[model samples]
Target chain A: DARVTQTPRHKVTEMGQEVTMRCQPILGHNTVFWYRQTMMQGLELLAYFRNRAPLDDSGMPKDRFSAEMPDATLATLKIQPSEPRDSAVYFCASGPMSSGNTIYFGEGSWLTVV
Target chain B: GESVGLHLPTLSVQEGDNSIINCAYSNSASDYFIWYKQESGKGPQFIIDIRSNMDKRQGQRVTVLLNKTVKHLSLQIAATQPGDSAVYFCAEKDWSGGTSYGKLTFGQGTILTVHP
Candidate 1:
């Protein structure tokens, strides 16, 4: 159906390696969000984007983390020189800005950085 | 920072029984609250939501209660089933910021297990 889709459902990479997670939001969704979930921090919003433009990335560590929506159908979260602490489940969600604040999430990408 | 948090880390319920999961929010400015269920290896699924103007709202076999006075929220599941077992999370949105923006602050989830 009309559900958000994520690529590379699971990933294992060594520290200092580059990792990229991709998401395909549901059609017509204008707002996309990136979140990280860990046992210690729970679910935290890492970034927010509207209409393919980033509106907030305050929660993300700009030094290595970057989020971008190359097109309406593709949103990507990339980590350069990834560290062990970056290991966690990353989720991508999309929703309409005007409709009730309901965000539809993709299954999620389980990243393990050694 | 997380605006919502849970009072309990886990809850166990018997099949056909009712289960209640509680959450507390730190921001009083929050106007919309929602509950979601996440199964193992799956994304969080929308359960239900309630507005600050209303005290309670119900959907299908689930009911959400919002206590604006105490900044508390609760989700009640009627006749718990095995399929309902999952981690439940409560999220809040602050519309007082002047823009809905679809920003949702989520809480540390509570794991619920239904015993058949």
Candidate 2:
């Protein structure tokens, strides 16, 4: 079965360190989304891309967080000078807009910043 | 200012019993609704979905009901099992003439625990 794949399933980093998470969306999917999950905030949309072009990143912190789809097969979310508050599970999801709005999620990257 | 929210934070049920999880959405323009189940240490998995034009949809042993008049949504699981224990979330998408870009807004999620 096709599914989104995420790298660094678990990571621990010290405050002020740079953290990068990678994702590979399902083959033939045209849309990718990045979301952050925290106990206090639930799930928050960070950004999304369509056809390798960013559609929106308004929910993300522009100062330190960046999301990019370098190519159709690879999507990345990076945090520079990450702080403890940045600790959360990051999920990558993808779907074909033409085939309805149903999206499938990866297992997620678990990040812990100390 | 629109948001999706759950009616209960947690629900407990016994194996073989039926369980219901309810969600409410503030946006009347939402046209699509989905239910997802997330187990511990895993991402959310799609369970079922319903559109604004439809009131009910059924999947393998699962059913979703949408009450647009009341802005309410519910997931009903038949024959609850211990494997069904997880956190469930209801998400809404309002294409709004493609302005929303098919983005989904998820609710706070309800934790379901099934006892054997």
Candidate 3:
């Protein structure tokens, strides 16, 4: 079965370190989304891309977080100078626009910043 | 500001019992609703979905009901099993023809625990 693949399923980093999470969306899917999950905030959409173009990143921190789809198969979320508060599970999801709101999610990258 | 919210934060049920999870949305522009189940240490999985034009949709053993008049959504699971224990979330999407089209807004999830 087709599924979204995410790298670094678990990661532990010291504060101020840079963390990068990678994702490979399902083949033939054109839209990708990045979401962060925390106990306090629940799941929040950080950004999304359509056809390899950034659609929105308003939910992400403008200063430290960045999401990019370098190509159709590759999507990445990076945090520079990450802080402890950045610790959370980052999920990548993808779906075709024509699918009518059905999105598939990867296993998620678990990040723990100390 | 528009938001999606759950009626309960947690629900407990016995195996073989039926369970219902309810969600409410504030945005009238939302046209699509989805129910997702997330197990511990895993990402959310799609269960079922319903559109604004439809009142109910059924999947394998799950059903989704949408009431546009009240902006309410619900997920009903028949014959709940122990394996059904997970956090359930409801998401809404706006198809209002803008940059926000297809963007999903998820509600705070409700944790469902099934006692065997």
True contacts kept of each: 0.49, 0.35, 0.49
Residue-level lDDT tens digits of model 1 in B1-116: 86553344999999999999999999887788889999998999999988788999999999999988888999999999999999999998765543335578898989999999
In terms of docking quality, model 2 is acceptable
Candidate 1 residue B88 Cα shift, in angstroms, is: 0.2
Residue B95 in candidate 2 has what lDDT?
Answer: 76
Check candidate 2 and list the clashing pairs. none
Q: What's the TM-score of every candidate structure?
A: 0.93, 0.94, 0.95
Q: Pick the candidate with the highest DockQ.
A: 3
lDDT of 1 by residue, A41-112 (tens): 889999988899998788899999999999999999999999999999999999887635688899999999
lDDT by residue (B1-116, candidate 3, tens digit) is: 85654344899999999999999998898888889999999999999888888999999889999988889999999999999999999998877766787788899999999999
Lowest summed lDDT window (length 10), candidate 3 chain A: A95-104
- Model 1: how far residue B56 lies from native, Å: 1.2
Model 1 earns a TM-score of 0.93
lDDT of 2 by residue, B1-116 (tens): 85644344999999999999999998887889999999999999999988899999999989999999999999999999999999999998767755366777899999999999
- Candidate 1 docking quality: incorrect, acceptable, medium or high: acceptable
Ordering by TM-score: 3, 2, 1
The deviation in Å at residue B26 for candidate 2 is 1.7
In each prediction, how many residue pairs overlap at the backbone (N, C-alpha, C within less than 3 A)?
0, 0, 0
